[model samples]
Target: MRISDSMRLDAIVRQQGHLKEQYANASRVAATGAKIGAPGDNPVGAAQSVRLQGALDRIDAFRESIKTPKGDLDQAEGALATAGDLFARAGEIALQGANGSLSATDRASLASEVDALKTQLVDAANTKGQAGYLFGGTSTATAAMDAAGNFLGNAADRTAEIAPGVSAITSVSGALAFSASGGRNVAADLDALRTALISNNPAAIAATVSTLDASRRQILAARTDAGLKSNRLDTADAAHQQTQLSLAAQRHAVSDADPTTAYSNLIALQGAVEQAISVARTSLSTMSINKFG
Candidate 1:
């Protein structure tokens, strides 16, 4: 049962090295406030933190995507409201023109107002939003309606992804909102009313009263659709906000060190390191004495 000085020295050196490594790691955790600086420190927690961060990033992207579409829907809604008001006034003009008692001069003057309303409705149909034309369907770069009351846009619906698997319609179809595609051609109806008033035709003017009402209803329906899309965007954004907050909390739990616990560990490791160095030195001194004697 012989004990060697070299063997004792080697064991002391190994023990000191291990204590120094632990002290270094604790110091980094305390100073940086990160429990998992590298995957080796806590592999499972580091992996979880990565996944949570990816989810947070996706939520942020989805929220950003909602912003432009929501603005487009608001502008579309406002344009439709303006169109509705214009149609209402046109309806009133039609009613007044339908009266047989009105003089020819009076009907001619009412025709002027109908002309103005028709122009305004065209302007509303051609409204541009953040992305492009509001009622142009997917063909948003150009005007939705031309000067002669023809629909310049297609009937396609533009859509955007509001959530992972959820898509929402963001663009309105001018062909449906203002042309015969929905029920009647709104601009043509205005033209008929104006023509009836100018020619002093009692029966034609009376017919426009019903046509104008139908056009107004079409605009109202389009407006309702825009409002519903806006509500869906709001709901999706709220969900994204909640998800981002939850993901952040989870990431913090896995990645961040508790300040108090980190500092306490650092202090404890520092003491252990100092004690290990002292023991190493004492062991080396005793070995030197034994060898020299």
Candidate 2:
């Protein structure tokens, strides 16, 4: 029960050190405007913050993925629309050419237009999307056209993840679209039209027209499919955004400290530390007077 002078001094020093540490901690919190400076302060909150940040980054990446592909699919849809219109026009010309009442000069003039439409259709099929070829699938390093108007694109599958484990297929492979049901391509039909016009064969022109009609239908069907996928992507994106917002809210509630409350508590801590220092100094003075004065 007997306390030595050295023990008394040591106890006073330890108390002062503890008070100083509290003051320093409060000041740091005030300056940094954060209640959780280190993991030791709030281990659970710190861990949750880390997880929330990871989720936010992933959601941002998912958003970017869907955005870029959406634009590319829209472009593909536009190109298909234009190509279909041209094919319909070529069909009209084919019907006109079959009429014997038309003179050779009329056939020549109509053939020129048919050739121009063919070229235009080629340009449309070779359209590029945001990342690569719209109708060329995943590979888009080069133009997707050959001398015979055949598409030389790959058949790669691509999808976008909208949620933690849910992903939607937003893109169609070029091979699937061009090959259609029976491995037929829009360009193949256009080539037939080109041959029919250049050869001035009425029967050939008619056959090409039929094929072109089918090609147009095929393009339309593909476009419809792309549109549906786009819609689904948009829905998924919205849902993902909502989930991200919820995560952010949860993180803020669990980990983020209120500046106003933190500041008030810090001020109180500073006063308490100052009071403890004053009392410790008074005790030291009393000890000095009893021992020496």
Candidate 3:
């Protein structure tokens, strides 16, 4: 079939233009390292990628919540440990004061040590973590205890979302957590011990030993609760991390480019474009100049 010269030249030019466009697109893809730059590149995959990103954001928020709870639990556990030690020491001092062989001077010396422990326990009760008070429950602006070891803070039960369907309390009420099972709090017991020590009365000091023991048990129980919360927080953190990882994988599957495949494809496309340009240039060069010039 005979073809018009102008039509033949136009066909070559169009082919060359198409090849050049492909080369430019491949160059861009390689430079950007993106197989799917926009929704139009892969509609279904892009939609899934967006969904996965949103899910990842939610998982991250959950993970943060779990982390904060764990921090609070850790601080509470530490404070309880200190409180337990203080109570145990108070019991020891009471026992020492109960000894008849000891004089008033000795009992006074024991009182000094107990006084220091009181301060120590008070400071421990004021421990703070990422969110604030460890034993205060929710009020973070002030310490959990007063100078006399009395519970002075409100432990408004605060909720932390560890996962989509799970939540954990991040703090314990200082008053409720520090009181004896059915008796006076640790501070009052220590005060009673101080009074008994002043008189150097074995019977009086001995009577307060039980109160101190009960106070110790309260602190230990609080520690146990904090431990359980810590464990749950760790589990929630791990689960949230897993969910985020899964979402990240989905995002990568949708948008990430395969380096090896993309590189090879780019090289092949560049070669094809170069060849098309060469042919088009040759055809244009051979075009007949029908008039004498």
Each prediction's whole-model lDDT (CA):
0.89, 0.76, 0.80
Error of 1 at 57 (Å): 1.2
> Where's the lowest-lDDT run of ten residues in candidate 2?
174-183
lDDT of 3: 0.80
Clashing residue pairs for model 3: none
In model 1, the worst 10-residue window by lDDT is 284-293
Model 1, span 65-107: residue lDDT tens? 8999899898899999999999999999989988989999999
Off by over 4 Å in 3: 64-68, 180-184, 281-293
Q: What lDDT does candidate 2 reach at residue 173?
A: 58
User: How many pairs collide in each candidate, listed in order?
Assistant: 0, 0, 0
lDDT of 3 by residue, 84-109 (tens): 88999899999889988999989888
lDDT, candidate 2, residue 63? Answer: 80
TM-score: which candidate is best? 1
TM-score for each of the candidates: 0.91, 0.82, 0.85
Best by lDDT: 1
What C-alpha RMSD separates each model from the true structure?
2.2, 3.1, 2.9
> How well does candidate 3 score on lDDT at residue 37?
75
Q: After superposition, how far is residue 214 of candidate 3 from its true place, in Å?
A: 2.0
Which of the two candidates, 1 or 2, achieves a greater TM-score against the reference? Answer: 1
lDDT for 14 in candidate 2 is 89
